[model samples]
Target: MGLDAFVYCRCWQDGLTPPAPVGPVGFDEEGYLSLVVSGGGYTETDAAFDGWTASACPHELMEQASEHLSNWTGHRLFQQALGAAGWSHFPALQAELPSANGGRMPAEAAVRVLDELDYFEQQAVIDDEVVLVDEATEAVALRYVAAYEGVLMLGPGYRAGVDPEGFFILDPDSDPPATLFRSARFRQRVLPSGQVQFSDEKKSVQIAMSPVGDKGTPPEWLRLEKQHQAPAEFGYIVEPLRRLCRAAVATGNPVMWC
Candidate 1:
């Protein structure tokens, strides 16, 4: 029901085998290594796609980057990069989209979010306390709190997206008081059913309330055993997808994110 990625490569011609999933959420550690870490799951071959190829090359690429990247890419450079990619599939993604990601293709919005990656960061809400160790990471988290001050992920949509963890990355001044609710203590909880619940219980009754994105909280990091430093903006998502695109170009294969 959620998004996953794959590489439709001719390399899978020999004997396509999708990385076996050990759990419903994802595959085992080794599967992640091949499917995502290296972005290479099959041996390269000169052979072309034939009657033997699997739709996904039996290996995944990304787990959903969310719709953030492409929608945020209303910026200049990302549009340029897509046009330059020489892949019409990418260029078409830049066209006016529908309701999913503010009139942008899911993939295209992903590109924009990741365009200014140097500014992105990743933080986690441990036990429901947005906790991050590094200076930059903490700064971004603090910025979202409005009580403190962040975003490469900043903009009109800033408040709607960031919680303690969503952006730990949007510029601090974007719309703080509204972005992170009223305080760091306002926790976002993930139930065993994998559903998210963000407590809007304000840190201060005096502070006015703003709406939160229904699916803003990152669904995966809820169980993080340790603080994960994704540093700066939405770059974490952008970089992986960019790599996939590069891989696609280099191998003349198709990039599949669904």
Candidate 2:
């Protein structure tokens, strides 16, 4: 399913005190913001900001955004890119990033990583309005922007086994089911059979797998990793997201995934 992200400010609405909105946090029945209107139950966005549009609104764009993203938001590729950049802090301590679409990034920290994202924003972010067409998919970044919604987290992962000539040709069994994720902390869960997952961007990524041939009809696993290897395409995700984080920062709220 697609992710529905919004900011939360625990104790902002209720009388309780707001805790440290950043760093490692485990899942809970009562999320950080238990009774806040922005806690994914209310349909109205706090009127304090304009950049953020709730996925529940009546606008058609938001309707589309409920299941998709646009030039303004971060999608899977962008999330993966952020993960690759934050890999240096993996294993011992998860980076503040919530690589997949679930979890929250305290507005303060999400935008604070603007330092981590500035280079990506400059080099990788997609122009939210007009990128280009991939002859194969018709629209590489276009359809993505249309997807303003997408995430689930992946736990620790491993490297892909490739062919003799060392090209990432699709492996129906493994590659088809594989994808990447970066998170604030690894979750403990039973992964269903037939899927492949991993971490360690420095050690496991196919950094030089296909310098140029990353295009064409590549599988999900290859495409995300290719974005990992290249810098130019990472922007498709950060444009909307960084803007959202900036908006959240302005509002002093926590970003939440519904």
- TM per candidate: 0.27, 0.37
Q: What ranges in model 2 sit over 4 Å off?
A: 8-76, 79-94, 99-101, 123-232
Error of 1 at 223 (Å): 26
Model 1 quality (TM-score): 0.27
Give me the runs in candidate 1 sitting further than 4 Å from their true place: 1-3, 12-234
Against the unseen true structure, what C-alpha lDDT does each candidate score?
Answer: 0.33, 0.37
Residue-wise C-alpha lDDT for candidate 1, range 97-202, written one tens digit per residue: 2223121123334344334332222321112223322232232222222223323233443333333443322324554443343333344445565433445344
Tens-place lDDT digits, model 2, residues 38-136: 435433343322222222234332221122333234444455444445544232113554445666666667656555566554554333332222334
- The top-ranked prediction according to lDDT is 2
Error of 1 at 199 (Å): 15
